[model samples]
Target chain A: MAAALTRRRFLGCGGVLLVGACTGGTGPAAPTSSAPPPPPDPLLALLEEREGLLAAYEATGTAHPDLIGRVQPLQSQTAEHVTALRLALALPTATSTSSAGSSSTPASKGGSTSGPAVPADPAAALAELRSAVQASGSAAESVCVSTTAERAPLVGSLAAASACHALMLS
Target chain B: MDPTDALQEALAAEHAVIWGYGVVGAAAADNILDRVRAAEQVHRARRSDTAARLHEAGAAPVEPEAAYELPFDVVDPPTALQLAVELESGCAAAWRYVLGQTDDAELRGVALAALTACAVQATRWRRTAGISPATVAFPGQ
Candidate 1:
């Protein structure tokens, strides 16, 4: 009981010291507008792009079998981000319409879509996908570096996938 | 006046991203094909939503072009991956900037989403390129 009390006392004193060390600017020049804090990193923009790319790929349904499996898992992971964003923005949550079942997709049946399998040119399809995978992997790595609490698994996995893409392409 | 202006900027970014995806998707490998395309679609929808919201608010949306200049030479898969990382990393900075200018919750929401999306894309591209993308700089410099 005495040890517990001592720990509490220490924590209380530490808290005061920590607060003393912190500094808040004074004077009219320093404006801390209550705008919801700006995002610490810029990687979310890339993730948004990836969401579109992933959807386009799924729409094509021509992804390699292994890719198909890998993407589905990644899609699930991305949904967490989708939820976090909605909460942060105080926006309504998107309904899941992605044939992928990850988020609310605005796509209609008639819209023309593109994917890795559809290759703009069939002969160069593998080469193209390999390049894209590598690119996607690199993009994912940057994301990990930029933010504190976003998409680590997906980023790391993408990096690995890019390597795999090169092998598959070869 | 409202968050829509910032939203429009984000839409513009999405347009550019979709364009980049087109180039990379054209040559993405078989295994990662689905992921590449799926991510593109997400951006398209986000852009569309932002555009609509801007239009509703009487904001002029920035139109995306058929193509944009690549940051690096994409002669091969590895090279392309490196370029993709740089491209998305650049994009992340733009969105982060937008997030800073707006205080509207809706804008913040989209900004958060966009930021997260860019971060993920950067990570994937970095991993694919076999480089460590400074994961330590969370929240970014």
Candidate 2:
């Protein structure tokens, strides 16, 4: 199905002049309108979970220098996944000031902020990473059920990739 | 979007990969040729299944190209492994789109298996090639 266009503009002056200019900026700059935040995109949760996985990989590498060779690649790939997921979800990587001036705050961070704990042993680290990947795969699968058809493949691939990672670490 | 379109595209990719893997297996090292052949068989099976599914759904499955343009020469074992990597990557990407577009639970399950298998095979090829970061974070993207 074609995606519905959610963004629109109403032009009052014969569809010629800008709506803001014609309305004399009297509508409180569109922020005081008190619109509720959009329900979180399920993909964002997957993305955040990926970030946590990256952090886990990084921490494992730091704690066990001997496993750096293995951990580094996983970390790099996890970071890449996070970046691709953010792009696919149409989310900005970094926070940007809102266009609605000084009074407007950027959207709140929508998902988990916790990172993986440092494991005690190399085997434990690998196990932790594998478990995390499995969880991520499950989460991505859930996102596939809720997202639009345009995004389902990307999300589904993420799940597949996560499973592959788990298999690799196994 | 029609889920069949995604399935047809995946079928096409599987057909291409099955063809490509024949070349890949031919040049692969003795140690890995069996694996390459196995991968080829996997894609062939998937291609057949996808076509059958599309037919059942009342959508005409796409036919494979007469021949595909190779991404690179499959000269030696490394190059052959690289080709396999590329082929499985294409397969994964195609199935990813299928998973996204399909709403049928059974079809999604099929697409998911195709995607996971392709991704695992790609990682194996990457490992055989001694490529860094053998497993991708996102297979299709």
Candidate 3:
């Protein structure tokens, strides 16, 4: 899996060749000795979105321990998504502790302090989680449509998986 | 593969799924027969839509086989539910392959919807069958 992820990143960087866009005269001047920064990857937003969803799962699980049986499996699946997206972006894997969900820690690179607070009622909490999953699935579907063919399968699968997760939550 | 080729593959899977669902509906208990019938109807619609899309693209849509070989004997509700999961999983894979074959946004949208439907239906069947962790991390991978 790690090897495949590295290969995808290598191919993506080599194939797209965004240098022309980066080097266009409209951009700020770069030092001649250094390479310009690569354009922001679209997948980065998706990766962060997955992380946020994972945090929501963790928050719900922690707040309502009785719902753990129902929440744990989905949370684990969401964690897998986080891992997959990270690998796809060629980002270093998060330490187990970080992903295990310390609420004080930011859920994503955007630096949100924590996931949305869980409702006191378990049923309501599940409903909230379902809404989040549905929204996430929509976001993933949009990304799947817009991303390169090489990346579409992964994103599309994530969108599908989120649909299933939403059903499970319901 | 060409986009049309991928669509043909998806159409073929939908054909097999429609055939497989007949066995599913037959073996499923009366309590769940409605669900089985609904699933079959969805596959039939998908098969028709896929075939039409292929025809529009000027490619021949593959026809369904007269009889499909079942992976196992689906003689009871348990086995029927299992077959349902298998059918959707196969369709999901086919549609996922289509996503990789086309850059057309419209085609990708259609493929994604099909894949998502398969994943959701698969989860429903798994849940009904008492499968733990009913949702997979990657639906079509």
Candidate 4:
């Protein structure tokens, strides 16, 4: 079982390598006789979803400074999700994109903001956040149900974590 | 591990969780007794469902021991709440393992739902106990 799991993980890493080679300018070109491109990895979509959730949490915190204490912990957890998803994909550790320029300020005091439109009311903002988390959880569950057993555990954990996040938001 | 073996393990965990919740409910405060009962009920239902699944798969589900050794003495409400958290965490871990041992979509759905339920319940227990960061990043992992 352990060897099987290792092989599955190695295959996942190979997928990431293929993606990287295809996208990176510095990487050598694919051979003329290369096999057909592999199917797109579902983990990439999950990674994007987690990064969006992190951004949404950060925006909510910025919009409602008073709610930062409540939001920061969940945001930190989301950041951890982003990291785990990256690790599952065997991707390089990039600088935290979600933390850039996330300093809390009073600039978005009113209802609407330049970035993500966080509701003016803290309760409403939290509700919105909860909805997003719920949606992401559903997505993760769908992927978990359909993906290979090797990938199911990671997405399954993501789904479970999102459920916890939704409960916290509630 | 075989999927049936994983299911058996999850059933064993559920049996233990149901038993642990008896201790949890006994020591829980009046204000939180409802939550304790609700959690216990869920575990009981899961236990029955898991046993049924194992039987359907032609595998004998693992039965619960006469009693499980408590990780720590459940002497008070705080300890009881901590036990509740621990119970759900165990359930989550078991179901997560099931996820990695099966490719059946229906089984995966069951495992994922159970994992999510346990993770949510664990967060609730943590919040009740005033634990920091009530939600874990990777619940079963």
Q: Which candidate number would show the highest DockQ if scored against the true structure?
A: 3
Candidate with the larger lDDT of 1 and 4: 4
The runs of at least 3 residues in candidate 4 whose Cα sits more than 4 Å from the true structure, single-residue gaps closed, are A1-36, A98-114
Worst 10 residues of 3 chain A by lDDT: A100-109
- Badly placed stretches (over 4 Å) of model 2 are A1-40, A85-92, A95-115
Residue range A121-149, candidate 3, lDDT tens digits? 99999999998888888889999998899
Each prediction's whole-model lDDT (CA): 0.54, 0.75, 0.85, 0.84
Could you estimate the TM-score for every candidate?
Answer: 0.45, 0.75, 0.84, 0.83
Q: How much is the lDDT of residue A164 in candidate 4?
A: 84
lDDT of 2 at A8: 22
DockQ, candidate 3, vs. native dimer:
0.78
* Colliding pairs, model 3: none
Here the TM-score of candidate 4's chain B is: 0.97
The candidate that achieves the highest TM-score relative to the unseen native structure: 3
Docking class of 1: incorrect
* Overall local distance difference test of candidate 1: 0.54
Fnat of candidate 1:
0.00
Over B6-91, each residue of candidate 3 has an lDDT whose tens digit, in order, gives 88889999999998988998889899999988888998998889999988888888988999999999999999999999999999
DockQ of every candidate: 0.02, 0.52, 0.78, 0.75
